[model samples]
Each structure stands twice: as C-alpha cells, then as structure tokens.
Target: MTILYMLLSSLEITDISEQELELIEPLESKFPIDKIKVTVCCQSSFICFRFYVLSSRYKWMTYKEAATARTAIGCGLIHHGILKGSCIALYFINRPEWLIVDHACAVYSLISVPLYDTLGPDAVKYIINHADLKAVFCMPLTLNSLLSILSEIPSLRLIVVVGGMENEVPLLPSSTSVQVVTYSQLLSQGRSNLHPFCQPKPDDVATVCYTSGTTGTPKGVVLTHGNLIANASGFTISVKFNLSDVYISNLPLAHIFERFDHISLAHFGVAVGFYQGDTMKLIDDFADKETPSKGVFCKSNFKHVCRAEYI
Candidate 1:
C-alpha cells in the first residue's frame, strides 16, 4: 500500500470529528489586538513598482493607517450609493491598495470580486457581466484592459484607478456615462463624510472568486466570512509565526491561496512586502542590501512562498 493509505489505516478514527467541521470566529473580532501593535510593520514593507514611482526605495502603511484608509474607502463607496452587499471588482496585480480595499469590503459588508490577469480579456468580460459589478479598483497597468471592455459592461458605473494620476488616465468616450476617479479622490470624499461600519455576520458572503475558465467558461465560487476565518485559523495552528516575521507576497492576490496567506500572516502581525511587479527583480528585492535597515536575517527562494526574516 502507498504511504498515505498506510498512515490513514493506522488511525483509529472512522469519521471526521464535529470540531473539524466547525467554523471559527471572525478575525475582525481581534481588531487592533494588543500584541499586534503594528500591522504592516516598517516603512519599507510595501514596495511599489519602479514604473509607478522612479524610486527604488519602498514604503509602508501601519495597521492604524491601513485601518483608517479602509474606513475612508468604505465610506467613500457608501457615499457613492454603493450600499452593503454590492459587488465590487478588484482588477489589478498584488499591491497594498488591493488589501486596503479588501479590508474595506469586509468592514462594510460589501462583496469583493477579484479579476485575474491570466483570465484574459474575454474571460474578464464574462466575469464582469456575470457578477454584475458596478465599480472596479484597478491600477494604471490594468486600466487599459478594463477600459477596453467598458462598452460591453453596462452595469459598470465607476472606475477607481489606484496609484494613478488624473492626467495619466486616457480620456473616455463622450458617449459613455461611466465615471472615473483617482484613489485619493475617493478617500477625500470619504473623509469629508464618514459612514458607520456595516459589519458582516460569519454567514455573510465575503467574496465570489472566478475560475481561470481553462475548462470553458469561468465559474465563480462563493466564500463566506466563516470559511475564510476557519481556513486562516487552521493555517495559524500549522505554522508557528512570530510578530517580527516578514512575508514577501509575490503571488497573485486574485487566487484564494494568496488571499488566505495574507489573512493568516496579518493575523499574527507579520509584515508583508509585495513584489515590485517584476518577477525577474523579485530576487533583487529579497536580497536588497540598500534597505534603510541592517542586514537580512534569513532568505528563502521558493515561488509564491513567504520568506521570514528580520529587517
């Protein structure tokens, strides 16, 4: 017999236990935990793409800053009449803004739907129409793709470009009634008129992740708040994480695995650094010697894996 079957046979258990099927409490309950003094860790924790800003140095947002931003963004959405349970699309590569918007969704009980680059234009169009998304948060690199498909998605009302200046955005056709705004503009409006948080229950839907459509048409999978919490809790138990640990997030956040990784690591106050949007330079980011901090504590070269070290 195979080693896996042999191991299973050695176990005395016949059926899965009740505890195994039970869901854990939401992580939001532990908001601003005493031990998690700082959420995103250091100033150089979240590095932006070199193309966006000519600086080689990185920047970060502390948990407090992140929480404030998320609250503002959530209020901004509400100000725009995007009520709770409304579906918002996240169409961009991994970045700090992505996480900020995601947290906004969780806090305000809005549903987040991720769009993957690997899904191409056709699949993306399909997913947008299928989900009936009204607003999409994108970056300069992904804006063109989204704009290209705008005429086809009538339900789309607003386009918030993250990390992009107003002038950089291409002029939309006069016929299209869709509005486009910068991320800063949204935050500004939100700060002016804040809205109360519309917290979600554990059974509420958190996200609807679409598949790659490799088989044919892309299919969206619904995930609840309880589902994410349970998965993140299980991950926390499997690995011993330290508060000083830093996780390098290089995987696409559109995928559930990467999403879970972010949630799990952040639960323990682990600092997460996003890749510089260039896979080739990822190694350089890991071995970056010019960081304002001292020498690196450790290194791991695995793909889509977190490298724990002190910076």
Candidate 2:
C-alpha cells in the first residue's frame, strides 16, 4: 500500500471542513476551541518506519500519544516556571522529538528560539546570550558544543536533553550553574501534573530563528504565531498535499523553508518521514518502491537528482 493510503486507512482523524480550514488564525479567540486535530498520525502495521533517527527506526505516535507528550512537556516546563512568553532554545536536528517539543511550546504559548545543530560555539553562545534563553531542548550533538560556552551564557539555567539520560550528562565547568534533565523525565512530570494549555495571540512570537553568521554576528528573525499559520495555510492551498501523500523531511528544521513545510504538512495531516543523516543512504530511502509521490529534498541535492524521474 502507498504511504498516503496507510495514513488515512489506519488512523482516525476528523476532517476539517473547508470553512474551518480557511480560518486564518490557527489558535483563535480568547477561549480557543479544540477543533485543531492533535491526532495527526500514528503507528500502523502498514508503514515500514515513521522516523529514521540515524540508523534506528521509530514508530509513529498516535494523537493520544502526541497529546500526552504535549501535556508532559508543557507541564514539565510549567513546573520549572517556564511560563508564557518565555524564550527557550530548540537546538537539535530534524527528529520526531523536535516536533513534539515544538507542539509543547505552542501549548504553553512559550517562544521558541531554534538553533542550528551545526552552529559553532561562538554562534551558539551569541544566540543564547542575545535571546536570553533560560531553557533549551537539545540533543547530544549540539549539547556537547554548547557546554563549552555554557559559562558565558548565564541566562541559561535548564538543559532538557531530548535523547540522552541524566547519567550521560556531560560535566560542566565549575563556574557554570545549569541543571540537566532528560526528556522522558520531563514527559513523566508533565503527564502526572498536567497544566492548563495557554492560548496564544496571533501576534505572539512563536519562534526566533538566527541567520548564518558568515560576515559577523548572526541576525535574529522573529516570526509570530499568525505568521506561521498564514504561511502554512498558504502552502496548503498552493501545494495541496493529501492523506495519501508520503513526504520525506531530511533538511535542517532550523531553516525557515524546511521548518515552514513541516508545519504546513502537519496542518494537512500528511505522513512525514524523517531522513537519516547520511546522504549516501538517502537515495535508498527514496528509491524504495513504496516511496510516495511527495517529498521535500534539500536544494543542494536537487542538481544531482534532477535527472531521476521519481523526484
């Protein structure tokens, strides 16, 4: 079966009427109605894999699982007093957990500051310090480099590791005062002590992305929740991806192009698969017979694959 067929047939999702789908604001009004579907996608026996994290395969998450994770991360943030409008850094690559934390941030109405995983220590330090980030949801790849400049970023207090355990926490400088917590632990705390979801205003800043600092200091670009919704809505109407569409998300989420597409695809409830890091293996993933019609590939790789008809 095709990836789109697998998603629609196996999962139970309420179809958003055309009227409701056209609504400009994603989270509308003072008391937001829960019309937005959290039950986007889930694991089924049909699909081979949902997320290829490096070489490992992770099954898809159901709506309930996604909601639970949302509550868990939101509650964990709240418990630590990371309230609405607070700035936090999402320093990781393209992974399933990245999207979970993103949804959780939206739940709490917290501002997200996305950092490239491959950023240099100076760039990392500059962004953290400039944003005055107090918390960060990161992975080992970025965390290791971040730790080197942790002392310089005094505003940062919490390091929520997305994939690693507390035991695996690296040693910090004696002067650095930062608390490390595992992602699962945060989810546990959130699950037990669920907090009320905060409604975000259209103008509320959803994320702050930094530009590549080729010349000097990186420039920060602020995008509001409304901006994101508008872009996603536009993309949906323009691209029109359906349930049967299977998409491969392999580009860096830190970039606006990739990030916007991911958010847009989620709104459409299309199945998205994350690519494993190796470009050599990427051909194998897309070349598979079951690979669907739709996929977002990197611009850099476009030239090489332009001759291939499957793309």
Candidate 3:
C-alpha cells in the first residue's frame, strides 16, 4: 500500500519531452524570441521560410531572417571596432530596419540609445553626447537633422543611413571623421564577413532610454536585458498571446513602453506593422474605400493586443 502511494505521487501529471522543454526554456531567458516560431506574410520581401505570422500591407520578416540579420549586422559592427558594451544610437522612426538594428544590438551586446523622431537638434545633441555614442542609424530625413550637430559629437565615428545611397548623403564637415554608409551596404558587408554572436550576462545593460525632458534635463534610464524580459514576461501572465496576433506599432519605439510591446509580440511569434509615421495616414490605409482587407477584426485585434499592459 505504501509502494502504491509512492508510485502515485511520483507519476508525472504532464508528459513533456526534453526537446519540448528545451524550446520552452528560452521563455525564461533574456532572449525569448530566439526560440519562438518564424512566420512571414505572403507579401514578404525576402524568400519564403517557415513563417509564423502574416502581414496585409508591408512584407513581414520571419524570426529566422531577423536572426540572420542580427548576426550579419553584429559582424559588421565588429569590423568597425564597435565591440560589446559600446553605445549605438538609433534615430529612425518605427520601421522594419529599427527592429533589425535593435536585434543586432542585442546579438552583439551593444547598448542601443534611441532618439525620438520629433526631438529637436539640441535634444539629439545632448543624448548622443551624454551616451558617448560610437555609431548611429538614422533615416535620410533624420540624418539631415543630425548633420547640424554631427561635428559636436566627437565619439560618433560611423553613420549608417537607411533608405538612401551613399552618394545621396549630404556632404559632411572635413573636420568630422564620421564615415557615412547605407543600411543595405552594411548588411551586405556583414553577410560577407560573418561572426559569432555575443553572449550577454543577465545584468548587462541593453539600452539607455532618455525621458521626455519636460521637468528637467532628460535623464537616461538604463535597462538590462533581464529587466526588459521581466517586463515582457509580466504581460504574458495576464493575457495569452499566439502566432496569429498582429501588432500595429504606432508609438515611438524609443519609449520603454513601446520597446516592451515589441518584445512581448516577439515572444508570441506575432507580426508587427509600423505606422507610416502619421496617424491620419494610417487610418486611411486601413480603411481605404477601394482596397479590401481580410477584415476589420484583424486590425481590431491589433488594438486589443497593444492596449495590454505596457510595463
């Protein structure tokens, strides 16, 4: 009778294999998205791989592609001597390239400092100087704004502009040692010279987010990879997410709230669509009188998911 009782207590309630357990373990790690499913929409710009989600408007990037880009970009940064713990600034609006740069920063253990799109030159100058940024990624328009203060930021040695060729970049001052290149060029260079990913400790700082500077001088909020994972994991407890969810990111990714929002979506293999930097334009694109969609429910679902806890 005692043996029978012991056997009953020892019996496993759930039958999960080691392989399944291994897949689930990443959920607790600082990089949960590394293990999640990879899915891309039919209109994806890249070749079809196993995709976990789909997009209606722009091409969707699968987790696999993101991982590849992360490694490739990390390699490029290494060639430029932007080693781990170096500060890299992202000065673009919410776009696919932003995600690629963010993940690449994580892959190489580089600290990402995001600049607000609406921020004036003075704010940009302060944050870049304060963080001692070594490199910067910006859109062509944002690059124009940075040009005015590029000479002031002595630590900045590299400027990679998105959506523009090198010849198109505005001439820089002779005194500034900054070398300008395009985003694709960097990716191509990196893919040609691949490198191993950096393994960051749980306490390693991931990003330095600055406040809006409404009250005083904008202060930098340093966040560790574990802190971000904790924030994303907390949201997972309240509302469950799956691969089917599509997130429309209208908020500035510079904000900690929006940064965690993307991390949470990545955890669930959810697709994200960036608003075209304009709210009214987004409304027209979604509700265009001529274009038909899968339905309004998909769009409404995005709102529901985004409205969840931000912290």
Candidate 4:
C-alpha cells in the first residue's frame, strides 16, 4: 500500500519522470478515484506566493516566511508540491488579460476585476463605500491613492498593501481609525502559531479589482483563489526556466500577470529584486558581483584649503 500510494502521487503530477510516475501511480490511485481523475490544475493564486513580510530590523523585507533566507519564489510556491528548499520570488507585471485565460484552466472560479489605474479619488471612494469588499491587497502607489479617499468611504475595513516603508503613513486624519498593513506584516500579525505564512483559503473572494474605465464608470471584478492559481500555472509553463537567477519586478503587482509569473518563476528557483517605484533609477546591476552603491556626501573647508586672503 505504501508503494502503491507513492506510484499514484507521481502520476497525478505531470512534471515527474515516467519511471518515477510509474513507480508512484498505484499508491496515488488509492486516493479517492474521483480525485485521481481530477487533473492538478495550478491556478493564478496557486502559481505564486506574492505576499511578503518585513524582517525585525525592517530595513529590508522578504516574503512573510523568508525571514533572513532569500528564495526563488516559484520554488517556494511548489516546495510542498515538488522542490526541497524554499525559493525567492518577485513580481513586476500586472495584466489581467494574461491572468484570466490561465485562471480559467486551474480552479475555474473567476470573477476578476481590474482595479482602475486612472480612476479619480471619487471613483475609488465610491467602490470602497458600496462594494462588499472583504479585503484589499495592493502595491505602494495604489495604496496611496486609496488612502486619499478612505475618509469618503466609511465601509472599508482593511487595507493590505505589498511593500514596507521606514514609517507607516498617516491615515484618516493623521491618526484616526483606519487599519493599515503591508502584506508581510499582515501575515505576521495574523499568524496564530509558529507557521508564519498562511494565505487566504480557495473559496474566499481574493480581490476586488476596479478596471480603469476610459468612457464608462470603472467596474469591480471579484476573484477567487482558484482563478489566481490557474493564472499562475499557465504562466510558469511559458517562461524560460532556470532557478539560479533573479528577476526584476517593476510592474504593478496588483495586476495578475506580475503576480502569477512572479510566483510561478519563484517555484523554478529564481530570486526577485523589487526596486522601489520607478525601476529606471536602479543601477542595471543583476550580476552577483556588482557592489551596491552606498550613499555618500562630500564636504571640504573652503577657506582653509584655499588660504583665503583676509586681514
């Protein structure tokens, strides 16, 4: 029976070797026959683990579970499923079109909406005021935009943004009644026991994205874990895979494309570096050898050095 389960588990996963698959198929077959027939679909949510937590020092931050150890994020994603060590991952692109098709293949529950990039404060306020938004996970810029109008919408309860900063921003009259947290901090705060990284469940509505409307009012799209996982798996298959490198994530993570590929790539053993806001200023230094530039200031005593003729 032990050998049978091993053989069965291998067959359920498509990426394994034929011999390995053959050896493990029977073992896995013992599982619910219905489960056996069910294909293991990686949805956008399952494809990547994008949320992060800041370290104790808070100078730098990584995924909620990363602690000091960096990872190839995709590798981390499938670590339970396949790989041995935790991997680092990063996200930059944010395209729902790419996320939708793949999302369909994995979990099949997709009610996704694109949070509008161009919507005004009024529109954002309206969405938060009316929509039954359970939670909001966003990047730094979007978070800022939302904060501006939070007072306008009293219905909003929680805001979960992605990155960390030296100081927490002042929300709701400099310091009123608005809960603010980064993705990493939220996980850390929410953890009940030793396990630091626990994502929201599959059935929970994952996101409430408001599309950027050019003509009509922006509409919110609701997404689930299944939808996200499907997007993630399809994205993993398209990239040129190699786990030893780092990916630059400049695009808005709120978009599924960045979130999916970033998480999927991590499973493949790639590390991700998230340069703040605009990536253009970052020195094009991905090579392991490039020394990070240290901030420096120069000061010289002008009169003493020049021997000023006074007197």
Instruction: State in Å the error of residue 267, model 4.
Output: 2.6
TM-scores of all models?
0.76, 0.76, 0.75, 0.46
RMSD of each: 11.6, 8.1, 10.5, 15.1
Error at 253, model 4, angstroms: 1.4
Superior by lDDT: candidate 1 or candidate 2: 1
Q: How displaced is residue 22 in candidate 2, in Å?
A: 26
Please count the clashing residue pairs in each candidate, in the order shown.
0, 1, 5, 46
Off by over 4 Å in 2: 1-58, 170-177, 288-311
Residue 76 miss distance in model 3 (angstroms) = 1.3
Give a tens-digit lDDT track for model 3, residues 1-311. 11111111222224433432222212123433332222333222221111115544423344455556666677787778789899998887776677778878875678989887777788888998999999999878788777878768889888898777778976676777987888888888887876655656658888999987777677999998767766665677786665455566778999988998777666555556554456766664445443321111123122211111111
By TM-score, the best candidate is 1
Tens digit of lDDT per residue, candidate 2, span 69-147?
6657877988887888889888877666676777777767888788887778889899988999989988866677767
Local distance difference test, per candidate?
Answer: 0.66, 0.63, 0.63, 0.36
Best candidate according to lDDT: 1
Write one digit per residue (lDDT tens) for candidate 1, span 1-311: 11111111122233433332121123323332222222323222322222213444333355545556776898888888888888999987766678878888887788899988566888888888999888999877778888888889988888899877878877777899777888999999887777666656667788999887889999999998777766765666667666556777777899999998877765555567665556787777767554432111111121122233433
Q: What is the total number of backbone clashes in candidate 2? A: 1
At residue 266, candidate 1 shows an lDDT of 58
